[model samples]
Target chain A: AQTVTQSQPEMSVQEAETVTLSCTYDTSESDYYLFWYKQPPSRQMILVIRQEAYKQQNATENRFSVNFQKAAKSFSLKISDSQLGDAAMYFCAYRSRGNDMRFGAGTRLTVKP
Target chain B: DAMVIQNPRYQVTQFGKPVTLSCSQTLNHNVMYWYQQKSSQAPKLLFHYYDKDFNNEADTPDNFQSRRPNTSFCFLDIRSPGLGDAAMYLCATRAGPQETQYFGPGTRLLVL
Candidate 1:
C-alpha cells in the first residue's frame, strides 16, 4: 500500500515570505503522481500543484511549486510570496494509475501579517 | 461552472439513526468519490463509483454504504450513526482514471 507522510503538524510564515512544507511517501510503483491540496476553513479542497514521477522538472503554478525527488521519495510544497489566503490545511497526496489516492495527515499553514 | 455539489452543508443525527448524504455533479464526470475527514486528520476514502460500478475500500466499515443510481448522482448511507462517525464528508469527481479531481465543499456530519 502507498502512504504519504507530512511531518509538520503546523507551520507559520510571515506575509510576503516563503514557506516550505515537507512530505514523503512510500510507494513501490515506478509510475505515480504527487499532489498538494489546500483545504481552507470553508472545507473546500483545492488543488495546489502536481508532479509526475517521470518528469524531472519540478511543477510550478503561480506561487506554488513542488520539489519532487523521486529517488528520495520526497515531495515538498513551496509557497512563495505567501498571503493570508494561503492559511489552510495542506495535504500531500499520492496516486498511481488506476488506484485510489492516499493522503497525508496534513499540515495547518498560518500566514501571519 | 461545472462542479461537484454536496447537499446539506451541515447535518446533526442521533446515535443509532440512519443518515444519507447526497452528492451531485455538474461536471458529468465518469468517477465520483466519497471521503471521511475527522478533525486534524486526512480525508479517508470510504468508497467510489466508476459510473455505476461501486468500489469500496477494504477497511471501510460495514456501517457505511453507497448507491450510485445514475451517472450524475451518488449517495452515502450510514446505517447506524455513531459518535465516531462524526466527520466531514467530501464528494469529488474526475473525468477519467488519471484526471484531476474537483472537490465539493463537504458536508459536516455531527452525530449526537
Candidate 2:
C-alpha cells in the first residue's frame, strides 16, 4: 500500500519570506508522479506543481517548487516570495501508474504580515 | 465558467435521512470521481466512473451509491446520512485514466 505523510500540521511564514513544507511517501513502484495542491478558504483545491518520478529535475510553477528525492522518498514543497494570498492548506499527493492517488494529511500555511 | 461543478455548495441533512450530492463536468472527461474530506484531513476517494463503468472503493460503505447516466454528470446518493458521513464532498475529473484530475469547488455537507 502506498501512503503519504506530511509531518507538519501547521507552518507560518512572514510575507515576502520563504517557507518549505516536507513530505515523504512509501511505495515500491518505480514509475509514479508527485503533486502539490493548495486549498484556500474558499475550499477550492488548486494544483500547484507536479514532478515525475523518473525525472531527476525538480518541478516548479511560478513561486512554488518541489525538491523531489527519489532515493530518499522525500518530496518537499518550497514557496518563495510568499504572499498573503498563499495562506492555505497545502497537500502532497502521490500517484502510481496502477493505483489511485494517495494524499498526505496536509499542512496549513499561515502568512504573517 | 466552472469546469467541474458540484451543486448545492452547502447541504444540511438529518441523520438517517437520504441525501444526494450532484456533480457535473464541462471538460467532458472520461473519468469522474467523488471524495470525502473531513475537517483538516486529506480527501478520501469514495468511488469513480470510467465512462459508464462504476468503480467503488472496497472500504466504501453500502449506504453510499452512485449513478452516472452520461459523461457530463455523476450523482452520489447516500441512502441514510450518518453523523460520520458529514463532510465536504469533492468532485474531480480527468480526461483519461492517466491524466491529471481537475477538482470542483466542493460541497460542504452537514449532518444533524
Best-performing candidate as measured by DockQ: 1
lDDT of every predicted structure (CA atoms)? 0.93, 0.93
Q: List the residue pairs that clash in candidate 2.
A: none
CAPRI-wise, candidate 2 is medium
DockQ, candidate 2, comes to 0.76
lDDT of 1 by residue, A55-91 (tens): 9999999999999999999999999999999999999
Q: What is the lDDT of residue B37 in candidate 2?
A: 93
TM-score of the second chain in candidate 1: 0.97
- Residue-level lDDT of model 2, residues B1-112, one tens digit each, is 8899999999999999999999998998998999999988999999988889889999999999999989999999999999999999999998864668789999999999
TM-score of each: 0.97, 0.97
Put down candidate 2 lDDT per residue, A1-113, tens digits, no spaces: 99999999999999999999999999999999899999998679989999989899999999999999999999999999999999999999999884678999999999999
Interface RMSD of each: 0.9, 1.3
Question: DockQ of every model listed?
Answer: 0.85, 0.76
